[model samples]
Target: MSVDSASGVTVPEPVPAGVVLRPPDSSVRRNQRLLARLGWLYSAPALLLVAAVTIFPIVFSVVMSLSHVTVSGSGFALGGFTGSNYSAMFGAQLWRYALEFTLAYTFGTVLVEIVLGTLVALVLERLTIARGWLMALLLIPWAMVTVISAELWDYIYNGVYGVGTSILHDLGMQQPNLLGTPTAAIISMAAADIWKTTPFVSIIVVSGLVMLPVELTEAARIDGANGWQIFWRVTLPQLRPTLALAVLFRILQAFGLFDLPYVLTGGGPGNKTESLALLGWQTMFSDLDFGPGAAVAVSTAALTLIGCLLFLKVFRSQVGKEEL
Candidate 1:
């Protein structure tokens, strides 16, 4: 016990018992830990669902790749495991062609879309009036679904009834089969993709344009710089980060290149336009070679992973510059 000198009252002092009182911060720490656990409990279901849908299939296929699995009358069983699956996947000539075509298609479409979309964005950003209507017109192509747009293009390029054929016939010359030859089919498919997806790029560029500083452009104009000079120096560099991000988005989507090629070319004209995704699908589903098919799927995933990693470096550069 202790005595207060002023009040002359006895007060309880510290107890020396074995039970120790927790400090306020310790109590708070305990409460935070409890809440964190509860948060994880709440999130567990979603995490499990994602694992089931995405992680499980990837792991399963990886396992399948190591086995001699085939779509036989017997059920799937793991035995005769060998590296032959990878050998078959890499040894094939068709797979190489598909891979090359996929790369070409991705780059081809992305290049055209970026150029065209940037041009459209520049034009729209300079307009003084009716941009709302113009924006709507711009989004029309992007709003249409990819498969539908591809099918539309397929009809447009139809050998017999297409507009191109009609025009050629009117000119009194041989109606060149647009989708019948390998090079023409690939070019036609790329054109369809560019037509459908360019508006999306334009939307991204336009968003970046809206955030651009008018003062910079004004200063350039005051310094007696021409329109082309100002835009080439000021506008394009400002848009690079957004352009990098947009390219990543488009490349991821374009590298897959499944439904568009499927609907338009059917990997036709002797499989000249087969994308990696389509080839993987055809191998896994159509041919029923589970081992080699899984290998194809893995290889495609690796290919995409490399592309994504490369873009991530560019994205990181953008982020670093912004942080500075």
Candidate 2:
């Protein structure tokens, strides 16, 4: 095809087969590829750190749990392993008691914390004055170092000069040493935990409460729903996910409780307050039995992981139903 300039008439150019003319600049594609590579390079340090800190320790612990290794004893090699540690733990009566006590303590503390925390959150949310100061005051217990909190509580529960006993006596209540008896010790531990962690749960619940759409509650109110009815029918369902997450975290924290019980009761008056973590610590450090202790520690980790997964699954299911 050709065009004649003088005649001002043009003939169409023939299209070439399988030929295409595209824009020349490929910098955008090149930059995208470059960026992808840079991202991986930037993330390498974090990935390496995680592997070194988290993955290596987890693998080492698993290996240690299966072998007979102690502070003075080293008969078993790392690669050469046995199931004796697990077998011994499973065959023991003390293991059962440890498990039961751990479960009881975890459940009791978490339950009380959640209930009290939720109620506090509700009241705080409804309050129009002094809420900020109250929240700050509630956080003081949480802010204290765990060991310090334990020591403080220990002084308060002391038999001779303890304010707790004095106050009880003043109220016409006969009070023994708080940590002397098993039941009382467990109750005391739970009280300390509730005092420390209820604020944490309240913070989580309060966030959810604040994020909730007010229209739903107002609509329910307009429909003549009572306060309790509105709460059960509206508020509770909305808060389920946050509550589950908070409770899951609390359960894990309570299950691994050591410092408070250690300082308060020394896991004593006998092994009444002895949790699985404390038992594992005693086995590893005090008794110098690394193999058995690592096994116990591994079991605790596995159980905690399972509990968290179950909680998340249940929470997801509930949230899904609510969404539907």
Candidate 3:
């Protein structure tokens, strides 16, 4: 202790155990800002690449959708801004039909795939033998390119010499023109999609299942919970987020349905199987209507974004309710 010169009062020296507060050095702040700038410098190349590939195309599509676009011998020429593209898209009957077909097809296929995939994952989770081999086999369809798979399905649905046709003929179904009719074409295309994509969902769910804590199920079993009870009370809730992730991925991919329908049915039998993506493709490439085609693409992207947002909101609310 010492007396202060100005106040003539005894003051205690600071204890070694007490924290001493001081203003941060300007050098420290300068160093932090320098580090942040370097970080951004390092990230700039990849960010520019993403902008070139993804953001530029999306912005260009939106611009084309909202403008008058013409294709010349040189390339696409953009005219003055106009709403005619969107107006034409909204006025078209094919647009309405394609929107409906895309939504319905996405809903049906995604729901079926999720259910079947979850079941497959559950079974695979319980397997004690050849699990790795079985998983590899299951992924074969998903690993195959969509165009190749679609071609394979096209052969299988061929009216004359298809294995499927032969089997059905043996069972007395006279004419199973799988891709010849509207309803059959839609169903056949959906079947092909589900066959190739279900394994993707199964892989995702299997990963989630592998990460799940075993203690919860074990404790539930000790509490006299049956398999079904344990699954319902313990597993399903935990798997909700995993299922939501699978659903989101499926929704995005399914809403943009093109390759399967294009390769298998060619959107034929009165354009009954034409999806939004296929419609956009036909409008852009076949008719060379870039503006309206861009509008269709933009509309489809907007719808997909809205659908995913709504699903996430509903899922969050459900999770909140379960927590409550």
Candidate 4:
């Protein structure tokens, strides 16, 4: 056998090593591929939904703004084209009224919310008893439906049998019709907004307050810092980011406000409370002028974007300085 093996060029026996080779399981590879595909499949519905709901509408609106469309006619048809809508908006004095009212509304509401919200936050921070209950109660205004709050405040500002009128009479003053006069109506609507939304701003600021390091405040106190000094130097610096965020949110909300003003004032008393949104609504629905209405909406959106960008830039600068 040995002689025969040499003659046939026999091969040596294989030696055992530390390593082994094996084929990957086809099932495992298939399962991994299937899982990856399934993950994407699961997310497809949400992506499609977002595209359909948000992206589609935005694109449609942009296109509609460039063309003329009527609510009663074929929706967003391309044939009814005109630049006259935007030209009319720019040339008319109505734009000035809308702009002035929008600015007034935004500033009035945001200013009140910030000041009153900070005050409330400070009060909440100082409280030691039933703080949770108080916080919950403060949130009630924000939790209520916006339309309901508008109606409630509307009734409160009513000339006869209104609580506001009653209070004025009790104070030995003639009860002025708050919702009738232009100045008073604007102030009254803004006050209603402040009452409803200040709690939201307070909640944001309170979170910032709660997260502030006690050590910094204590150090300030040990350095003989008074209440005002501590607040200005130690507390406010830490809360700048929160305050920025709160103000930005409040501003945006106040800028786009429609339902409350619509429900309460109906943009009445000589268009004193007519915000950009309300004006757009009137143009589109009341006048059946879709082109101008869409133009107003587009302009409003651009203004909002500019405002937001400015806020973000300022916020980033402040945050950077704070970090340093």
Candidate 5:
């Protein structure tokens, strides 16, 4: 090519050493496309099943929420689409109460769970003896079915001849009916939730604690950092993501608060303990108002999604500041 340039004639550039030029193979690309198509074909059944199981129900629920639905012997009879369902939900005082109660319950329980769970995880992380046995014991509460756990709590809070009542009576609190009143019922439900789910949070946090880089803590200690200082400065920042994940999971589950209130209080004491889930159930199954019920469900889902998004945004901003 240089000699051809000197000769002032057009010439192809010389190929670099250890390089080869060749035409692209159309067959290779065709084979790759075929494999991709085959993979999609193989996955199509599972995708369809997932749609049937999850997506269809969601879409149907949204549709039901938007329509005038009536229950018949045949099935749900859907009438013309209307906004009455959401309007009724918005105008009803019971819906407002349930929304407020559910939000309060979710906030209180998730906050307590995160704090208690993180403490438990920290303690568990430092324990070198019987850690597995301790963890198994801790997990018992979480492993129990929610219904069964609620039932057990129900028994404990029974107005008469119950263990909690008996202990309270002996402590000079006479006739302390734990679930007989609004405030007491709310507290009892929150206690049961905290007791049952704190272990779950602890497990997640413990896993994160286990995976944290030990070198950071050691370095912090070598720099004259105390245990509290190390925890605040070195440990907590790294654990932010794990804590955010735990918060997200707990918020989602707690916002759908139902089983505990249903089994323990039955949304009783003047429906003070009624949650959005309980309200939806009562509206649909008890009142046979499927449209408003679906609206309640859809609203709960939307609120939960919004709350989680806001939390994640705040968490990300906080993490960014910490990183900076």
Candidate 6:
């Protein structure tokens, strides 16, 4: 005999017709329902805090970018709404140069980091002795504070008392100021960043390597693959995602380079090493041009976001290829 549900039509029941057949009582079910709701209640505070800090600043920046906000005679004033701030950013050659410099800095540093970091991770993976201590040693530079490291490099690059200057004179050359030239200064800045962040990239890559399937590699070896061949066929494809993540992170971090260049070059040598972040800071604080500064910040942030998205897109395609 068939019985209808609560919204019921007529039913032929095994028990009495009016007797509803409710599902069996379960403490587990009731507990699960309570826990699901409790989970949301617990997470609400942290989620709200994150939204307040992140969303608010991004919204405020976009808004300020649209308006001509300036420090007025008595106080800050919004000089109505216009896109002149962003237009000025585009028209100025300074901003364009800074943008190009930032891109080059990001590419150079991240490329070096990826190559060196991967090599380091591979060496560590094959190490039979003192790997843990060696990993710790590698992490020391990464743990050092950015400003302190930059200052240390600046001292080394000093025109008078610098190790660099001493070496130059010992080689019978004139006194050298590493930061006094455009190319040398840019290279010096990239070197400092590579020293600081390569360990970070290696650590992430090493984690991915740890999860790599040993059996698959062994199988490839048994099939007559050499070290490079097995790596090319087995390990590299597996590492694609991890490498993509490493590149994305370094790109974002290096694109905002300010502290190192500020300490080392002060954006001088014709402002050849000036980054957009440095420019934004100068505009906002040094020149006190709020509108243009916000616009710079907004444009840079947008560009970084696009870069991240593109990396993810390419990584996703690589993943699909692996599946096939």
Give TM per candidate: 0.86, 0.87, 0.90, 0.85, 0.90, 0.86
lDDT of 1 by residue, 97-150 (tens): 999989988888899999999999888888889988988987888899888888
User: Could you arrange the candidates by lDDT from highest to lowest?
Assistant: 3, 5, 6, 1, 2, 4
| Full ranking by TM-score | 5, 3, 2, 6, 1, 4
What is the C-alpha lDDT profile of model 5 across 1-324, one tens digit per residue? 444656778777888999988657997788889999999999999999999999998899999999989788887899998999999999999999999999888999999999999999999999999999999999999999999999998889888767899899999997898999899989989999999999999999999999999999999899999999999988998998999999999999999998998999889899899999999999999989999999999999999999999999999899889778
Query: lDDT of all predictions, in order shown?
Result: 0.87, 0.87, 0.94, 0.85, 0.93, 0.89
Question: Which regions of candidate 1 deviate over 4 angstroms?
Answer: 1-23, 314-324
Which 10 consecutive positions of candidate 2 have the poorest summed lDDT?
70-79
lDDT digits (tens) for residues 1-324 of candidate 4? 133455686555554797565557997799899999999999999999999999897777666677866454555355466777788888878877898889878987898888889989999988899888989999999999999999999888888988998888888878678888888888888888988999999988888999999999999999999999999999998898899889888888888879877998899888888989898889888887777888888888889889899989988997888788
Against the correct fold, how does model 5 do in TM-score? 0.90
Clashes per candidate (backbone, < 3 Å): 0, 0, 0, 0, 0, 0
Error of 6 at 180 (Å): 0.3
Candidate 1: 10-residue stretch with minimal lDDT: 70-79
The candidate that wins on lDDT is: 3
Tens digits of per-residue lDDT for model 2, 249-309:
8888888888987889877879988888998899888877788888999999999999888
Question: How well does candidate 1 match the true structure in TM-score terms?
Answer: 0.86
- Superposition-based RMSD of candidate 2 using all C-alpha atoms, in angstroms: 5.8
Residue 59, candidate 5: how far off, in angstroms?
Answer: 0.5
Which structure is stronger by lDDT: 1 or 3?
3
Clashing pairs in 2: none
After superposing candidate 3 on the true structure, give the runs of residues whose Cα lies further than 4 Å from its correct spot: 1-24
Off by over 4 Å in 6: 1-37
* Of candidates 5 and 2, the better by TM-score: 5
